[model samples]
Every structure is written in C-alpha cells, then in structure tokens.
Target: MTDLLRLDHVTKLFPVGGFFSRRSMKAVDDVNFALSADKPEIFAIVGESGSGKSTLAKMMLGNEVPSSGQLSFDGTDVAAIRGRAAREAFMAKVQPVFQNPFEAFNPLTKLDEYLFATAHRFLGASNRGAREAAADAALQRVGLSLSEVRGRYSHELSGGQLQRIAVARALIPNPKLIVADEPVSMVDASLRMSIVNLFRELRDELKVSIIYITHDLATAYYISDRVIIMQKGKVIESGDARTVLEHPTQPYSIALKGAVLPPDPAAASAIIRQRQVVAG
Candidate 1:
C-alpha cells in the first residue's frame, strides 16, 4: 500500500558562522520513513538534545522544508503544497501538540476560544450552537468538556488540564495525523501516564496516526508501536518498539537502554552488571 506519509532521503542543512567563514550543519541527514494510510499507530523518534529529531518533526509538519529529498503526504509532496486553500487543507489533516501546554495558549484569553476557533475553522461550525457542540464533542474525547474550561484562562488550569485541552483542540479538526513533541514531559509525573494512554486511545479508537517525538524512552516503550533511535542527525536503529528497546543492536541504543535504571535497586544493579558484560 502507498504510504500516508513518506520521507525519501530527506536532509535539512542550516548555515552557521559569519558570512566569511560560513559552514553548513546538517540538522537532518538522509532520513527515510513511511506511515501507512490504513494503519494508525504511534511512531516514536527518540534521541537526546541536538539529535535532529525536532528537525524531522518540523519537516513532517511542513513547518520547514528539506534541503534535499521529498516529504509527501497521501502521495502529495509537502513542499508542493502552496496557497491558502492548499495549506488549510493540509492543516486539516495534520495537527500538532507542543511540549509546553502553557505556551500553547494565551494567559489572558479564555481557553474555550482556541477550541471554538478550531471547530469553526476546520470543522465548519459557523454558528454559536454548532461551534459549541463541536468544541464540546472534541473536548470529551480528551476527557474534558467546554463547560469545565468555558471561561477559564490558561493560568487557572493545571499543566495536565492544559495539555488535555491542547489535545482536545487538535482533535477539533479530526486530523488524520498528530505530531506531538515531548507532549507529556511538562505534565506532573502522576499524570504523565494518563496523557500517554490518551495517545494510545487516539490511535486505537480514532485511527489517528501519531508521530510521538520524545527523549523519554520509558513512555516511548509504553506507547509506541515502532521506534526510531537517532544520533547526530541520522537514524541509528529502527524497528518494533519492544524488540528494538529490549535488544538494541546499536551501541548508542544499548547505552540508552542501560541509562534507564529500573525502579528497584536490585534489578537496576542486575541490569548494570548485564550491560557491563555486554560492553566487555
């Protein structure tokens, strides 16, 4: 089957230093992947800071163009999408959830405004009644409702609540794909799992394909169907999430797995010993 999204040898480069001593730094280097149109699953891109995961996400979202190669959605080149009509159509199919929920909205604005605007713009809820109904329905998917956040400002809600609202607003368009960058990293530890589980529900129930970009391996192991480990702007390992994580082939992947200490001290010690043996 043709993919819903495909990145064919994509590379992004940015210039650094003054004009006289300019040099190109490759942010994404020959990256390639595909997501099936009929399949909805969470695909994780895991790497530490400066690994080019964010660059890949931005290219996928069409926020940035690749210096080389093609990025296509539903067999259409993302770069070829031009004009208001085309961009709007693309946006209706793809949405984003940022890491910081607080920064996603205005402190002074009512939370429902974003929700209503999304519904009105994408879902075609032109009137008050239609917009309200649409907003309420989308919010319910993320375990929230317009009533709870109707007149509330961003500062009033907890981090978890704000993140859920962000998810709700993204769902207002019933997008086919969502690119979430470190989505749960900002929420409280107690509530992180709930948000992770929400992504699972979105994939299984709504059939929405998700590109879940994060540095948290534990949550990536918990939520992703497939995982890609990146290093220095290149994919080091890519395969089934559990298999790749549990039996990582690359040295970097092995090191990453070893870095995640088990909750129990005894188990953690055992893992450390095992990793030491592998290293030896």
Candidate 2:
C-alpha cells in the first residue's frame, strides 16, 4: 500500500535575534514518520510545550514550510503544492481541528455557517438544500445535527459542543486525515472522553486517519494505536502506544509518564515506584 503521508528528515528553522547576530533555532529537527494510505488509525504525538509537535503539525498542514528535507502526502511533495486550487485539493484530504473550541469560530456568527461553508466549499454543495443536507450528515457523525445549531452562536454552545461542531465541520470535507492539536484540553473534564471517543469512531467507522497531538498521556494511551514522544524538538521514544507508555525507556518519556497522576489513590504509590524504577 502507498503511504498516506511521509515526513523524511524534516526540519524547520526560524531566524532569531537582530540581523547582526542572527542565528537559526531549530524548532523541529529531522522528524520522520509515515501513515499508510490503505490503513486508517489514530497516531499520537505526545509532548509538552515547545516540543515541536505543533510546528510539525503546521509543516504537515502546509501552513509553514520546512527548511530542509521532504514532506509528502499520498506520494506528492507538499512543497510542490501551490496555487489556490492545489492548496484546496490538498486540504480536501487533510483537515485540522484546533484547541480552544470557543475561539475557533466568530462569536456572532451562526454555528451552522461554518458547517455549511465547509460543505459548500469542499463537497461542492451547489445549492442551499444540498449544503444543509451535507452539513446535517456531517454533524450526525459527531452526534449533532444542524437543527440543534442552526441559528446558534459560538457563545451559545458549551466548549465540548463547539468542539464537536468543529470536528463535524472537518468531516464535511470527508478528509482522509485530521490533525487535531490538543483537541480535548479545553473541554470540560466530564466531556473530554466523549470527544476522544468520537475520534475513535471516526477512525473505526469513517475510516479516517487522525494525527492526535497532545500532552496528556492518559488520553493518548486510551485512544492511540501508535505513539511518538518528543522533547525539545526531537523524537525520544516511539512504539505501540500501550507498550511505550507502560514501559517508557527514555528519561524524558519516563518523566512524562511519572507526571500522570493515577486516578486511584491506592495505585498511586505503586505507579510512582514503578516510574522511579523506570527513570533510574
């Protein structure tokens, strides 16, 4: 099977400091990975702030260009994608879901407007009825419908609802891959799992591949098929999600695992000791 996406020795650098004393800061360094075109699964990128996960996502989305190396989607070079038509074609296959659902849309606009716009833009829904039907179908995939959100503004819905709408909008394009960056961090604790489960549904039912980027190990462990741990812009450890997180080999990864507090008080001490053993 052909690869859906491939990043080969990819790096992104930004010039810092004044012109006379400029230096390149490597925000992403020689990152490499691939997703299979024939198989759809959720791949997690685990890291803390400044770990280059977001930069890597940006590069994959064509929002930023890599300084060196190659990024290809479905065997086509990302850098070679140019012009509005090409960019749209690329985006039709790859969509993004951002953190902070409240900020994702304009507060004054009707919530369904985004859904309708996405349907009309990508799915080629030429008429109002077709656009509405398309939006409704996409929303249904996320456990929402247009009638529930037709005239509502962003502020009218809860964070989780807005995020679901965002996911639904992404689905309107019928994208093969969705790059979700910290998608559940801002949602209510009680509702976070629902959104996470929705991603799993997308993968299992819709056959969509997801690039699940997050700092939360618990959620990553729950939903990811494969995982990559990053620190300071480089991949430190990667493997089957359960295997890597259950027995992290790197000090950085072990520290990250240690930071996740066990839900049961009775298990906390044992987990801490296990983490200590692994860290040492």
Worst 10 residues of 1 by lDDT: 267-276
Instruction: Report backbone clashes per prediction.
Output: 0, 0
TM-score to native of every candidate shown: 0.95, 0.95
Per-residue lDDT tens digits for candidate 2, residues 1-280, read 3999999999999899998999989999899999999889999999999999999999889899999999999899998897998899999999999999998899888988888888888988999999999999999899998899999999988999999999999999889999999999999998999999999999999999999999999999999999999988899898899999999999999888977888988788887788688889
Candidate 1 lDDT over residue span 1-280, tens digit each? 4698999999999999998999999999999999999889899999999999999999888999999999999889999999988898899999999999999898989999998888888878889999999889988999987889999999999999999999989888889999999999999988988899999999999999999999989989999999999998999999999999989999999899888887899988998898689899
Query: C-alpha displacement of 20 in model 2, angstroms?
Result: 2.6
Residue 136 in candidate 2 has what lDDT? 93
Q: List clashing residue pairs in candidate 2.
A: none
